[model samples]
Target: MTDLSARDIERANFAFSVYDFDGSGTVDAIYLGDLLRALNLNPTLAIVEKMGGTKKKNEKKLKIEDFLPIYSQVKKEKEVGSYEDFLECLKLYDKAEDGKMLSAELSHTLLSLGERLTDEECESILKECLDPEDEDGFVPYAPFLKRLIAGPPEEKPAEAK
Candidate 1:
């Protein structure tokens, strides 16, 4: 596999801790589903069934090396959450007073907001926002935008004084 970033490594370690709920140094299928649900992700239906799937019933525990698939699913759901939040923020960029976030306006707003994207990058984002189904200059930020930027950062509580 490719090298994992520091942040990704941190996330993986934390996920391992969360999965190893019993302090048993390993995670079984039961713990795996629990971990997924705790993070607001639905567990794999096969695991939810617990006694199904092609794999032998005795081979239920998964090693850290086997965590890549679960971690990938977690990342996907986390990104979906970010995209949902970003769409809500896009409401602030409605310049035409018609509630539509136009491609030109979105491109300008993103740049003005210190997105630091190149012209080509911005155009690429605009293209993703506007597909064949959309009319020229008509882009639905709510329906799309997630295709451009991943979801928002995970929120943390403020430290008490």
Candidate 2:
């Protein structure tokens, strides 16, 4: 908790969501295998399975708390802050604890990012990506960020001669 910022907290939370692959609420070897592989930890499937059978009854199970230190280490090693850094920081919000982002959550966050967006523009962006008919009214964070990253850039008017 000392070194971990809100964004770091969000990143771990996102990974935790993915690690719960079976929707079992409790993670088994299968889930840990996938989680380890996603982070490129290089454990084989067989090893993963062995891990599943080895847990002690009185021991506590793995949680995001156990994962964050490794996540923190990885983040420190390769950090190159950019606009993505802002986005990384935005992970602290973005309804990201759920690993899905709501348009309403993003719109409020847009207002607070270093460069300001008018409420109109926030509403406009939401209209473009968020479907009014979707019952959950949320989008996956990766693609949602990709859409923003890959979309057209805003341009100011040309200067007068």
Alpha-carbon RMSD, candidate 1: 13.9
Writing each residue's lDDT as its tens digit, candidate 2 over 12-54 gives 5776777665564544433565565555444433454444422
Question: Across residues 11-89, which tens digit of lDDT does each residue of candidate 1 receive?
Answer: 6667777777678666665556555555445444454444222233335776666665555545454333355566667
Q: TM-score for each prediction?
A: 0.36, 0.35
Off by over 4 Å in 2: 1-84, 94-98, 130-134, 153-161
Model 1 residue 2 distance off true place after TM-score fit, in angstroms: 19
lDDT of 2: 0.57
The lDDT leader among the candidates is: 1
Off by over 4 Å in 1: 1-81, 95-99, 132-136, 149-161
Which pairs, if any, clash in model 2?
A: none
